[model samples]
Target: MKKFLVVNAGLAALVGSSMAEAGFSPYYAGAAIGASQNNGSEAQFCDECTGSKFTMHKKNTGAKVHKVYAGANLNPVWGVEAEYANLGDTYSLDMYRPEFGIPGGRAETARARQKTRGIGLSAKANHRITRKTSIYGKAGAFVWENKNSMDYTNLDGINEKYKSTDRGVSPTVGLGIEHEVTDRISIRAGWDRTFNTGKGDRFLELDANKNVTDLHSVKTDTDMIYVGATFNF
Candidate 1:
């Protein structure tokens, strides 16, 4: 019985030492820089006619993004993080309308641009593949602000500028791999996507009499790939 107790105590101590060597930190901070792609569609409809509509599809509209984050590890497999991200400007679309009835076709041009930023809170789950390497998945909600602007020139040689701001919360999901370089430092690469980030709000095109003629709406999802390093305290 005494020998059995001694062996059990030895095994318990060994397990405790292994847990200590796992390098779980209570708090950490990190920064990342990456490129983002915006994908979605824009629709234009005549306010007066129910069936008159036009739709434009957008894909791979690229932008630059950067994020700073801080988090606490609750245990070996769970953590929570808060982050602020600057999602740079993206060119939404360009449209040209040609007037074929004129002696020489005159083209009317329209262009759009969008700027976005957000803050998010996430829950992270980790699986250790080895002593120094782990893979993680995160799910979160992001509150974002998007600013959209359009410049249009018509056949009458008149330029019209329309601007709108939209704010909302979006669901964010990500997967990442991390490798520990030291007890206090780790490097990671990840991919994150925010769904239906900028939705709702309609931009109205008005006629000369100030009557609403057409309504335009844009919706998009944002995807980002990033590499970063974190320091634990």
Candidate 2:
């Protein structure tokens, strides 16, 4: 019986040592921010014009957009994050009316500044390669809305107006690193890229038969750099 007790005590000591040497836990929650950019394109033409000689007009624009976001991390090397950001003016282009007898005077202009604001939720998984550093990858979807408007005057003293709102999905992939400062705090830095696919609509005012047209499809790709803190719970 004494020998059995000694064996059991040895086993318990070994177990305690192993637990002490295991270091910190695996689960964490945090936030990050990085540089961002956005690009979009749209086109509109008279839809009611049935004549073969009708003119076609188009416009394309692009610019740089920047914003920031915040999120949280979960267990099993996987976490969820929510971020909000706004992109500045990217770019703009204008196309004149085509060379047809469509009687369309000036082409559509891609000017007028634009902005973006939205929130995104994503799921991420991370692997620890060392004691103080780890690499992680994340993929998720986001819903974003955009509003664009343009105004111009025609030769016939008529005013033209165009505005649109679009909502779609944005998929993202990112790589990041985390450094632990204490048992309750850590610093994180990461870079992520996302592709947004969708289109924006437009409204045109024309006296000839109340014309309406669908604008062009727009796609955007953005890169961001982020650094933030995390609290382990």
Candidate 3:
């Protein structure tokens, strides 16, 4: 009985030491760079004119995104994070109103560009699948700002430029997998999405007397995939 007790005590100590070595610290910080796609539609309508409407569909507008985040682990399974991200730019081109009656039979064209950035706060849940591998999911809210500009040209060689800035808060969600390379360092890959990020309208046209003649509105969602490294403290 004495020998058995001694062996059990030694085994307990070994187990405790292993647990301590594999445990995560309370705080961590990381940075990630990735590609993002914005999905949405841009529409222009003239309430005062008949049959003067145009709609542009934007699908797969890709951009580069980078972000930095810091978080505290409340326990082994739950944590919270704050992040700032530069979500990048999306561009689109549309051709409207083909002038078949004209000699060249050309069409009126419009080009648009939009830029976005945001800060977010998130609650994260982690599940460990192995000694060095884990998966996580996060839900959060993001406050975003969007800058939009458009240039339109008509068959008569008249050019118009319009700009607008819109700001709003949107819901965000993400899922990821992480692997520990050492006690203090880990690497992760994930996908994140922000919904209804761009939500507002812009004036696309004005009359000779400076009255609002045409209006444009757009709504978009952004998605990103990234790989990054984190350090625990």
**TM value for model 1:** 0.76
- Alpha-carbon RMSD, candidate 1: 5.6
lDDT of 2 by residue, 141-210 (tens): 7666656555544434456666766677778777888776776677878776667544533233346555
Q: What's the distance in Å from true for residue 190, model 1? A: 0.7
Better of 1 and 3 by TM-score: 1
User: Against the unseen true structure, what C-alpha lDDT does each candidate score?
Assistant: 0.74, 0.54, 0.74
Question: Compared with the true structure, what per-residue lDDT tens digits does model 3 show for residues 1-233?
Answer: 99999999999887656644556567999999898886654442232333454434444656678999999887778999899987776434454666764545666766666677889999999888888888999999999887777778877878987777778889999999999988888999999998877665432456876454543334567788888899988
Pairs of residues at least 3 apart in sequence or in different chains that clash in candidate 3: none
- My TM-score estimates for the predictions, one after another, are 0.76, 0.55, 0.74
- Least accurate 10 contiguous residues by lDDT in model 3: 41-50
Candidate 1, 1-233: lDDT as tens digits: 99999999999887656655776677899999998887643442223322322223333556668999999888788999999987665336555556763435666666766677889999999899998999999999999887777777877878987777778888999999999999889999999988776664434556867554543434567888899999988
Better of 2 and 3 by lDDT: 3
lDDT of 1: 0.74
Per-prediction backbone clash count: 0, 10, 0
Model 3, global lDDT = 0.74
